[model samples]
Target: MKNRPFRERMGFALEGIRTGWRREASFRTQTMLAGCALLALLVLRPAPIWWGLVAVTCALVLALELLNSAMEAVIDLLHPGIHPSIKIAKDMLAGAVLTISAAALVVGVAMVVATGPAFLAEIGL
Candidate 1:
């Protein structure tokens, strides 16, 4: 099959998210959390650059999780037997998701810390 263009690839990715949101509890939870975090960022009015970092990092983690899920699905479809190579591939992809999630958490905390004082002050705390 010919490689899909970038726009087509993005469309497929959006479709995956739509399907996942309907079927996957974890995806729904993460999306809900992302929505909450976005609201906080807007209400708190964090430094513009830090807000961008947090938003991008959160999106990256979610995107990585989606890709990891797709990888596992393809591996299972290709080889239903117990295969060390397939196990390794799936584990590595999962590890990538973990790493990205951890990084996103760190960035998110940093953004909150950087802006928390101002937010509190504005609230008359």
Candidate 2:
């Protein structure tokens, strides 16, 4: 098949995002959580470094989840029957997402705790 133009590729990506949002429960949940985190950061106005860290980490976590989901879908499509190799591939992709998420959580918590006192002072709490 001929490669799609840039615009067409973008349209395909947009469609995938819409479908994922509608069909994937995990994607929806993570999106909601990310939105809440963004709201909190906006309201609190954390330090520049902390804000950057949070934003990048959140994006990385979401991206990893999306990649893992896509990998699982492709693996299932290619191997519908139960196969140990397929199972291992899926498991490894899932593990990658889990590891990234855990790391993101730790970074987020550490940033919050490290800057909590300053944030409270800013808000006169």
Candidate 3:
């Protein structure tokens, strides 16, 4: 697989994204929320640095989510049984995803708070 062409590798990644969108509710939800954050950034026109910060946070969340989903799938395929070690591993994966998600939320909130006056003025509030 490593020897495959770059095009093939990108196609595989796209397929994985499609699978996540179709099979994982959390992935779909996070993707939508991330889209909203990006939309907010577009509308608000915050600082240039903020664009990078927000984009990175959103990408981190989706990437972590995909990693979490891929690992859980592997665990299920290999074990398919209840075990303490597997449970802890799964819990840690969940915790990691949750931590990044929370960080993304904080970055989003900070962006809004920093742009509050401009946002309000634009919205006629």
RMSD of each: 2.4, 1.7, 1.3
TM-score of model 2 relative to the true fold?
0.87
- Model 1 residue runs over 4 Å out of place are 1-11
**What are the lDDT figures for the candidates, one per model?**
0.83, 0.81, 0.95
Of the candidates shown, which would achieve the greatest lDDT relative to the real structure? 3
- Model 2 off-target regions past 4 Å? 1-3
TM-scores for the candidates:
0.84, 0.87, 0.94
Candidate achieving higher TM-score, 1 or 2? 2
Residues 41-120, candidate 2: write the lDDT tens digits.
78767789878887887888778777778888888888899998998898898788788778878877887788788889
Q: What would the TM-score be for candidate 1 when compared with the true structure?
A: 0.84
Please write out the lDDT profile of model 3 over residues 1-125, one tens digit for every residue: 46999999999999999999999999999999999998999888999989999999999999999999999999999999999999999999999999999999999999999997988998999
User: In model 2, how large is the Cα lDDT of residue 121?
Assistant: 93
Candidates 2 and 3 compared: the better one by TM-score is 3
Q: Candidate 2: what lDDT? A: 0.81
